[model samples]
Target: MTSFALHLLRHGAPVLPGRLMGHTDGEPTAEGIAACAAQAADLGAAHLVSSDLLRARAAAEAIGTPILDPRWRELDFGAWDGLAPDRVDPDALAGFWADPDANPPPGGERWSELVARVSAALGALAPAPTLAVTHGGAIRAALHLLCGFEQHQLWALDLPYGVLVSLRVWPGARPTAQIMGLYP
Candidate 1:
């Protein structure tokens, strides 16, 4: 079986810095775009894709023309969208943190749902070196889908803005991948 590199790059910092930005469509700061572009500049990926949101798309455009895919969008926080952590109920937030599937944000997507969505997106990728400029949440979802990490385990990773995760994937009906590298 042949393996290809799949790079998941988190979008740069959004104009709205500290908030639950899922589906909020915040714009990226100029420096943030520059940082993301610089990080991806030398990656010679054969294909590039990005989330349809402004933050991700703008950062991706700084690097190159990217295929826009909504499936790469951040996890939907629904009612909690754009609110700061301090603004939300601590108990509710804790519930979400403890088990996202059972205690998703008021109207948000479940962890399993995010995994499923990312799984579909991953399944559709061609077996070639690819890079996707997307959200931290979406990147985590992809990690879960491809690497089989549980939601809690995924939380341990510190994927800040402009982070990159490279994976070696063997594409198939049930694809599998291994971590090749992680770049901050």
Candidate 2:
């Protein structure tokens, strides 16, 4: 069986946190940019992929490799996009977390939908060592696929800015992950 290695990276520090970032474009902080460069230096990927978001794209570019921009973005928080975590309704947040797979954000995409899109994108990528720069939600989704984690558990995973998580993928099986945190 032919195996491929995939490096998943979370984009560096973002500007806003209130609303759902989903497809909203945001740039990385100066420190975040440095972190991205450092992570790229650490991974040294041959092929790079990233979310179209400016933050993610910048990170991909810093890697100094060919990058593919994919449309599989983070879950749309809809009307909840820009609200702070504390400002959001506790019961609603709990409900969303309780059944993430089935529940869609007030105007956002469902967890299952995001998973499917990411899975398809992963399938379309060339089978080789590659780096994917994306958002925390995206990384969490990929982790769900790679680790068979429950939706609630997705938040449990620690994915810091510009971190590189290595995974080996095979046909019809869960990916094997080697998580490595890098310096900014």
Candidate 3:
């Protein structure tokens, strides 16, 4: 079966560090751009893609000219976008976390929705080595979809800013992934 290598690089730290930044555009700090660029330098993927969001785009652009795709954007936090965790309604936040599918943030995209969108985007790409600069949420969704990981298990990934996870995707009746490396 034909396969593709995907280097999923999480965007660098945003100007606002400790907020629910989903769908909220934030600029990458200079240091953040430098870190992500350095991490991306040796990846050597033939193609580069990025979320249309500012932070991810900045990092992606630093490494190479990237095809900006909205489908690669972070999970939409809706009313909670850009708000600090402590500021959101506790019960609502907990409920959303407990069952992301059953309870999306008030107007936010559901977990399943995010997974589907990202899957569709990935599936549409040509099978080849590619780098996608994206958000942590999008990366988590890709991991969940390709690795059969239970949603809650994803939280333990602990992927920080500028991390790169290399994956091989076997496209078929069910697309699958094998982790190649996790680069710091």
Candidate 2 ranges with C-alpha deviation above 4 Å: 17-19, 172-184
Error of 3 at 5 (Å): 1.6
What value does the lDDT take at residue 24 in candidate 3?
94
**Sequence-dependent TM-score of model 2:** 0.86
Clash count, predicted structure 2: 7
> RMSD of candidate 2 to the true fold?
2.5
Candidate 1 lDDT by residue in tens digits, 1-184 = 7999999999999888889999999989999999899889888899999999999999989889999999899989989999999999999999999999999999899888878878878887888899999998999998887888888999999999999899999888788889999999
Which candidate number has the best TM-score?
Answer: 1
lDDT (C-alpha, whole model) for all candidates: 0.91, 0.72, 0.91
Model 1: lDDT of residue 19: 94
Q: What is candidate 3's lDDT per residue for 71-159, written digit by digit as tens?
A: 99999999999999999999999998888999999889999999998988788777889999999989999999888888999978988
Clashing pairs in 1: none
Please, what are the lDDT tens digits per residue for candidate 2 over residues 16-46? 6444566777667877777877766755466
Which of 1 and 2 is ahead in lDDT? Answer: 1
Error of 2 at 120 (Å): 0.7
How far in Å is the alpha carbon of 115 misplaced in model 1?
Answer: 0.9
Candidate 2 lDDT trough over 10 residues, lowest sum: 175-184
